[model samples]
Target: MAITSANQLELLQTAEAVAREKMIDPELVVEAMEESLARAAKSRYGSELDIRVSIDRKTGKATFTRVRTVVDEVENHFTELTVEEAKPFKEDAAVGDELIDEVPPVEMGRIAAQSAKQVILQKVREAERDRQFEEFQDRAGTIINGVVKREEYGNVIVDIGRGEGVLRRNEKIGRESYRPNDRIRCYIKDVRRETRGPQIFLSRTAPEFMAELFKMEVPEIYDGIIEIKAVARDPGSRAKIAVISYDSSIDPVGACVGMRGSRVQAVVNELQGEKIDIIPWNEDAPTFLVNALQPAEVTKVVLDEEAERIEVVVPDEQLSLAIGRRGQNVRLASQLTGLDIDILTEEEESARRQAEFAERTKIFMDTLDLDEFFAQLLVSEGFTSLEEVAYVEQDELLVIDGVDEATAQELQARARDYLDEQNKLALEKAKELGVEQSLIDFEGLTPQMLVALGEDGVKTLDDFATCADWELAGGWTTVNGERVKDDGVLESFDVSLEEAQNMVMTARLQLGWVTIEELEAKAAADAEAVAESIAEAEEAGA
Candidate 1:
């Protein structure tokens, strides 16, 4: 192309050297200047003429000059450089490469200088973008030292090494104020390129911020002597960390904690005194889970390894402490441990009651053909005696499984037979034991009296034979929803048929008490014992 002879090429050469000193590749600098000078040429000499800028690849040297053909009469002056001006360059140079007395470096009045300045500024900005992008993009998520540049709308602008970063409003520490030019460190959240420049995001509130502090304070973590498995944080409140060691002898938590908590205290001070739980991690699911639930002593951790879940059973008082206020502690624990944890409590009253009812149940199995599930149901419902279901009629017994009307009737028959046998055996056993045995034991009377005493809350032979005694009396009782007592109830047990009237007279006169039921029961018990003796004798005769 036709070249301009009177250009300022020295300025382009100087700019390249400055770029190399700044760690920028000289070739990249040359390319930038070439494009910028082309833009400047376009603005200076419009589209009517051809202008080109070239840089020597080896020297990173740039030359910006205009090229135009020599025509007889220049219709467009910028497009035609005269032939006399082309004489100094190659005499053999054709129309394209011919030289001319190029435009002199006389200061452009207004437009050209402005155009040149725009070119330099645009080129510099693009160069800076490339430089910053390469430097900081790889450094994302790393900690960096920066100086506070300004604060706007709660966001702080920091000048980190390569570019300015915006520390967003929310990530700032509570109630803390930062002034211009204040030195600080932060986590690099993001690095992005924009029209203006590279935009970097910074954070001071990330839990990784705490982990970083540990790395700085504890050499073991950086050197790989310890490892951090996880961290969970409630920025202004509490945090939990799960840690493990690379070396068997090293305790990851203790290393992070330092002697007497010095290292942890340093981190705490950095966090403005937020509580930290440094927990040791375990490959054993149960043990790891126990450590995750800090402060609360875990008696047991039942882990469902396949489901990745755990049930933490703690004492009743530890329940709240384990769960924390509103479940904050457990929530962080879940985050740190990677296990879903549920908590449970055991009560003594329920346990003792269960044992008591379980013992009552073996006898039931000996007689009833109920399934384990139904047996458990019965136990749960407090039904330990055959008498509980014994008096139940067909409809009530039908409510229990495996018992139809026939079965229910059979159950009632068995219950009655067992009761009868128990009564006979009771007297014989009493005779054998000699605790409360005598022919006078049969001094009670009546079958209905016996049934009522045995099945209708009578509970004892005394309740049957002495129902109307002084001890069985009450001063006031509800009858038809009204409180009333006959005053002679205390002497009701003194009833006798031989002196029925006299006994009544004696009871009413002396003690104002008598019970016909008691006198009857005493006679019946006496007769029951004699019947048992005769049956035994007959069986012996057989």
Candidate 2:
């Protein structure tokens, strides 16, 4: 093919056709061609020369040029021309003016044509990937249906119309299998751009998959009359979904269940027979949790709001059902309600209550030197510790009809005395355990905590700084084959997690283990403030 005006029109037409086929902009193809042509021209025009090419969009004609800047002296002969040399290109050309030479188009050889083709293909591929990424990025978390195109090492690739999505082995529902060309529905877990192309990740076992299925089956949900609060799934086994209705007339659970369970059954069939329990959601967490534990009646619920934990007492016969097989029921309920749940039979709850009462009564009797009757009275009034007695207002303590002003004063005094005695003993024991005086005097460290640290061999600022918050505060673990919080330094010292964290941070600061720069910066700021105050004082005196 000759490098002529007529041939250039054919080239433009070819570029347009390729752009249309690749679903990319035609201008990108032309730009890629211009780059390729410029590279080829550089080969003939001394590779060091600044060569450029442009193809006219209207005329389909090519222009080749060498670009050189007019300068007082030519430091680089390839890119800069002296003003004297630049004068021939244009009489008015001055320093800094670009001197462009229009060179004739080159006849592209076989090698140049192959290079141009590669450049065009590379640009087209990049454009295609970007287009796919933009189209599907926001569609993540939505449901999508596709055909299984192929399976590679247990990862199924699905053709999602314009692009392909990967359904990894772990994302597939248990017992669910698909072959080539099999139709499949999935949730769009994520869409990410990679070096090769856009990767679309699909999931069949995500809890959101069930929620999306309900949206498809129930118009009430799609129209916003019913809303899905939360979803938890075991995938191909059982799942729990919490729903609520904005309209009082529309029953959220009934709408999700469909007529004779058709809607929920559709979702179940898609999940390969995963059982789903649609429960009504409530603003009250306890009510929501009770609803989440379906087919099992809850007799009583004790909530520890600070810990986000709930203990439920069920009838003796209903304990197994409430806990479910392998604790799946309580686990799903916890996930749905966003709380940790502990299931107990009525008898178990009573026994636990009696044990806690006796323990608290014994603590009051031993620590405050209170008689059994007085200790029982304090425990009944919800006074759990000597600290409460010592810190509680006299007016609050006076509300107990059996206690007079003198008696309340005596109780508070005795409580303070007991705490003081305990601290004094703790300090003595801490010294015996090799705890340093500096560590015992740390601002956030209580005397009792110092004793525990000493016993645990955390005898210095460095030792305390090395511990994580969980090491000081209690953490959950298996106790007697049941998962419960393990006693730690905080539990033994009766300190909160926040206080423990603060104590550890204080230790780190004291030891100069970290935050030295921060401490110095703060010190500088304080010094500057002090200097400003002194200047103001001097001015006032003057």
Candidate 3:
């Protein structure tokens, strides 16, 4: 079939119809049609010739032409023409002017028709995928309604209006099943273009799914009077939402719950009976944790800011309730508060308090050559270590019971004497073990740490670089008859995990260890190099 002037209207109508049906820009369809015609023209004009096609948007006219550049010297006969031969196409043509040769329409044979069809179909499909990707990309992290199209290996395929979204197996709620054609709501987790087409990933078990549901059900949240600070969900079981109010007049939790439990109840119903707890959000983590552990009363909360951990003491009767089945309650609370939580009964807390008191009292007695009575008095006054007593103001020590001016002076002197004696001993031992003075004088490293590392033959920065923070700090060590401290092998460096990792990272950075990103990039580069070497070897043998 030939594209004639009489049929140009029909061609434009066909392009417009396909554009409307596919929901793509009409211009894109016209461009695709032009591309298909160009492919057909290539068969008539040699494949090496620069044949082009364009359809006039207003006139619905298709123009096909061969493009040749006017050149000083003729090279390829199909692409370049000398200035002398180009005068017929353009009267005042220069050496750089592009000449166009108007070509009459030729009837497309069977093979050419088939080629045009494939070209049109491929271009239209690409345009559709691009349009779908753009439409859904902005909808990521939003809830969308769809019908279950099919199931493949536990993954549910949902038919959203404009495109298909895959609810991956791991993203589905536990124990939830969907039949074909069943209506479902899912969160649009991601929208991306891949080899086949645009892929929209959906999720039903995401914490964001529950948060979006609350935004839909609660007017205050939707209006921005209340904000969702965090969400933790155990899909199909229980979930917790932390909400805060910008307007002091409105209570965040109550606003989310609605009158007679109507607002939150709607969210709960949508989650397949997942129990929702609306807790008031607070800048204070302990207060937020107390509220998060609702239905069970908390007696006390001890926070370790350095460790990012909390210890919550509950009454013996409330222990099981605070922990929940399989420790889910505390786990969710931890997630909501962004702190590690350890739940303990009041009795357990008291025992731990006593144990700490004994440990502090022993440290003072051992370090300062103090009697049990004086050590116990110092511990009672909140003096945990000899360094605190040594560095504390004399006035502060005098405030303590039974600590007169002379007694305070004597205590400070003894504490300083003990520290100096210990430092001297550490220096002697370090010298004997060939420990570097630079490591010994490092700011964060203690004298004991240096001595320990020296004994272990980790004397230089390079030697220390080869060791993990746990190893440098010492994890399991023995002293005398019994364990002086069970926290660390060095008996003193009871570093938290964050501190340990920082110490290792610091050492590595100083010693030229690869960063996390650099490590990954290096691994990729090495893999590519190896693949190339193998390809070269294979080619050599071939």
Give me the displacement of residue 158 in model 2, in angstroms: 1.2
Better model by lDDT: candidate 2 vs candidate 3: 2
- lDDT of prediction 2: 0.87
lDDT of 3 by residue, 190-212 (tens): 99889999999999899999999
Error of 1 at 445 (Å): 67
Specify the highest-TM-score model's number: 3
How would you encode candidate 1's per-residue C-alpha lDDT over 316-417 as one tens digit per residue?
A: 888889999889999889878777788876554347566887776665655565556666665665566777767755576677656578977876787677
Against the true structure, candidate 2 reaches a TM-score of 0.80
Off by over 4 Å in 1: 1-9, 17-23, 43-50, 57-109, 302-309, 347-374, 377-542
Could you give candidate 2's per-residue lDDT for residues 1-542 as a string of tens digits? 34686687876898899888878888988898888888888876778999999999977788999999988877898899887887877999888899788987787788877877888788888888898998899899899989999999999999999899999999998788888999999999999999979999999888888889999999999998999989999989999999999999989888888899999889888888998988999999888888999889999888987467899999999988999999999989988887888888999889988999999999989888878888988988999888999999998888886899999999999999989998999899999999997787778778888888888899987888888887888766657845576667767665667777777877887777669688689779999999999999999745
Deviation from native of the Cα of residue 353 in model 1, angstroms: 13
Measured on C-alpha atoms, candidate 3 has an lDDT of: 0.85
Candidate numbers sorted by TM-score from highest down: 3, 2, 1
All candidates' TM-scores?
Answer: 0.55, 0.80, 0.83
TM-score of 1: 0.55
